[model samples]
Target chain A: MAQLFWDDVEIGMEIPPYKKAVTLMELNRYAGANEEYVLIHMDRDYSQKVARLPDVIVMGNLKYAYLSNMMINWIGEEGTLKRLSAQYRGMDIPGPALSTEPTMICKGKVTNKYIQDGDHCIECEVWTETNEGQVTTPGSAIAILPARS
Target chain B: MAQESLITDEVRAAIGVETVSPPELVEMKAIKDYARAINWPDPPNPLHVDEEYAKKTRFGGIIAPWCFYTTLGRSAPRQRVPLPPARVGMNGGNDYEYFLPIRPGDMITTTSKIVDIVEREGRAGKLIITTSERTFTNQNGEVVGIAHGTGLSQY
Candidate 1:
């Protein structure tokens, strides 16, 4: 895979999308990684009986973590991810896969913050869509990429 | 109608005040498993594992995904005043800025401050949005990242 440089980006360009299949094991594993002891994410009965969720839904942070991974992977090594933000709009049930696609939002001359400092910063509208074709997490990011020059 | 504001004086007073804790060590096992859980992939690009590979990279060593800030060194995210026992609370969202990555064997500390508490009437009726800003700093006093997240309390 070739590294993505600032010169290679164009506004409105869509990077290749990536997919992640969710599972209870992944969720449980994340619980240990994140040190989150929320029973809602761990206890199936509690999630169904109390929270009334479809099943033991994925952790909100874990969902965003997946999104961050997508953003970092798309930009490549020289690019620095400045910020990542996501809003959890709906519950995401495991057993389904989520696809992430990020579209370039910065155009020629790159008139954003980094450019003033002589850095080429790329911005993207990043989002995750569930298997059912619903956008579960919608967010945006700013990445500073190395210039070709 | 002005609509009764859930932003009580107590909540307003909490804004900008910080609740900090001592530094917590970052363990390798925690970072490694987290990478696996997220399916970040391994080997060939072993920045998360192989020290030799990491040393050749710009980061100069293994770096955990910045998301590790969720638990690393961060403590007591619950509102200082504490929400009523009856009101159910859930994570609202996460907005993170990564200046640096959490490296293995780093002793990090987090400083959390309540920035805002917005009260609104939503589909679930009464809602209290507790927003906090956290700064992650490594042992050498370099900032790792800033995480501004929210927790929603439904009354």
Candidate 2:
């Protein structure tokens, strides 16, 4: 991946979208990795009967991580992720069997570009939208990118 | 008659109460696992998984992803405010500010506290929003990151 320089960025530029399909196995792996064993995220019966959900749902932390991944990919090794924020507004279910199989699309647009405390900083509006056209997770991020000089 | 507020005196008193966890040693394997889980199907970033590649970078060594702090010291007990029963509780959101990258073997200590509680009317009925702030510091006493988490309960 080519390095992204602050000099090359524009205020309205949109970063490439990152896409992923949330699956049950992927959720299980995340559960182990994060050590979050919430039954509502892993057990179908528990999610339906106990949580009163149609099915097991994706972890909000995982969606946050996805947004982080997207930022990391955009910033590259030289750039640093300074801040990130996300709000879990809607529930997203995983499926091939469920009513709708949603693909998680992580998208971002550069909102501002400036130098702060000697670092070239870029602020962006980030969010995750499902194929069903729902913005389940909306957020923002700030990153420090290297300058061409 | 006026409806009673969910922010009881006990709940109000719990604000600013802190819970500090013992220092936790960061492991390379846990970092790799977390990166893999996030990257699944696709290979994880070399900065997180490949030591050879990372050693050549400015970080000087493999560094965990910025959000990796969330997994640290999970089993430690946290202070919680007493509240009325609600039909559902969920993670409302998270806000993070990063100052440094987490590297292998860094002794990370976390201190968390409930900062605020607010009540609002929702479509369901009453909604209680609790905000907690956690600070992560390294062994060298350098602050690595701070996170603010919001949890919501609906009655």
Candidate 3:
């Protein structure tokens, strides 16, 4: 991975989109890793019958992780992730109900750049959208990148 | 007739009450599992799973992914605002600030508190939004990260 320097960033620059096709097994794995065993996320029967949801829903925290990964991949090892925030505005279902192809698209746009307390800071507006173009999670992040100097 | 307010006096009093969790040791397996969970179909980032490669990077050793803290302190009891029962509850969102890298073998302690609770009339009828804050500290007493979470309950 190449080191991303503050000099390389410009306002309006967009981070390459990170895409994934969410599955039931993937959601189960996330439940094991995070210990979030909420029935709405694991058991389709419980999710649909008990919870009255359409199907097992993806964990909001997992979506948060996706957004973080997008920024981490963009910043590289030298850059530091300072802050990340998101609001879960919509719900996403995994597997066949959605589509066979990758549906979750994670994206970010650099919104601002400046020096703050000796740190070269870059702020970005980040979000995840379904293939249908509905923004499920919307958020922002701040990262510090090394300076060329 | 007006709907009854969910923010009772008892619920208001529960705000700012804090729960402190016992320290738990971070493990390499947990980190790797988390990395794999999020990066399914595609390989996880080497910085999170590849120890040999991470040794040469600035982190010196493999570090957990940015949101790994969400997995910590799960067994411990949490403080919840005393709101009236509602039909359904769901995760609203989260805000996280990372101050340090969490590495394997590090001990993490978490303190959580409900900061605010508000009621609103929604399309469904009534909604309760609970905002909470959690602080994560390492064994060295350094604050590694802080998370602000919002949970919504609808009636």
Candidate 4:
């Protein structure tokens, strides 16, 4: 893990994109581990008839984790994940892949840079949109970057 | 209001109560194993063994993935299983506010408080979103991080 000097990053810098395709196997594993017996996350018939979902969908936390994972990996070791905020906007259903029809989109652009009480920080406008151009989760993050040597 | 019924006097008494505990030292190996378990691509754990890279990390030398909370294990209080299972269940989302750096060799304990519970009508049925605010503290009692998450249960 290489340290990213504050000077190396600039405003408008775009964090690389990331994609996630939820699967039944992954969904079942999460449900089993968390002991969440919500039919919509595992039972396809229940989700379709009861929840009106296209199919059983991925859990919201896992989606958020995917977004968080993207940002953390972009920040590297010298950077610290300070804050992450997200709103659940839509669902990611199983079948034909959630983001595959077009693409599973995870993109972020640096929006602000500053020092808060001695902590070097950068704020970003981040989001994940579905294949059809629907914004699934709108989010933002703050990271502490190491000072340039 | 539907929320009023859910927040009975008995439940109201449980609000705003803070539970504290020591931090659990998250291991790098555990983080890597979790990613492997999920089979997620581009494992987030930066493969590094040099002390220099580890020393710069607030998490001591161990580089933990961002979603370490999922990796941090805690048993959920038992709940009665309602007959005819709920039709929907979802994780609303999470808001993480970082305070202190989580260092390696540090034992982390989480303090979780039930913040709010609201009932709403979804396409499926009566849905409940229970929000909980959890704070993580190191062994020295230093506040490390705070997270807010919601669990959606539909009946």
Question: Compared with the real two-chain complex, what DockQ does model 3 have?
Answer: 0.85
lDDT of 4 by residue, A36-79 (tens): 55677878887788677887776766666777777877887558
Q: What's the distance in Å from true for residue B27, model 2?
A: 1.4
Q: On a 0 to 100 scale, what is the lDDT of residue B140 in model 4? A: 87
Model 2 segments more than 4 A misplaced = A97-102, B1-3, B73-76
Q: Which model scores highest in DockQ?
A: 3
The TM-score measured for candidate 3 stands at 0.95
Candidates 1 onward: DockQ, in order? 0.61, 0.80, 0.85, 0.48
Runs of candidate 4 with Cα error greater than 4 angstroms are: A1-4, A8-12, A25-39, A49-52, A95-103, B1-5, B19-29, B37-39, B47-60, B71-73, B76-87, B100-106, B121-126
As a whole number from 0 to 100, the lDDT of residue B63 in candidate 2 is 94
lDDT of 1 by residue, B35-116 (tens): 7766632222366767787888898988887677787544545446544542556788899898987888998888888888
DockQ of 2: 0.80
Q: Which docking band does candidate 3 fall into?
A: high
User: Candidate 1's residue-wise lDDT over A1-149, tens digit each?
Assistant: 57888887777677566676666666777887777888778877988887656777778888787777776677777678888887777777776323233211111122233364787888777767776667777777888888888
- The positional error of residue A61 in candidate 1, measured at the CA in angstroms, is 0.9
The TM-scores, one per candidate, come to 0.87, 0.94, 0.95, 0.77
Chain A vs. true chain A, TM-score per model, equals: 0.84, 0.93, 0.94, 0.86
Sort all candidates by DockQ, best to worst.
3, 2, 1, 4
User: How would you encode candidate 2's per-residue C-alpha lDDT over B1-155 as one tens digit per residue?
Assistant: 29999898998999998788899899999999998998886798888999999989999989998889779655456676788677778889999999999999999889888899999999768899999898998999999999999998888
Which window of 10 residues has the lowest lDDT sum in candidate 1 chain A?
Answer: A102-111
Fraction of the native A-B contacts that model 3 recovers: 0.90
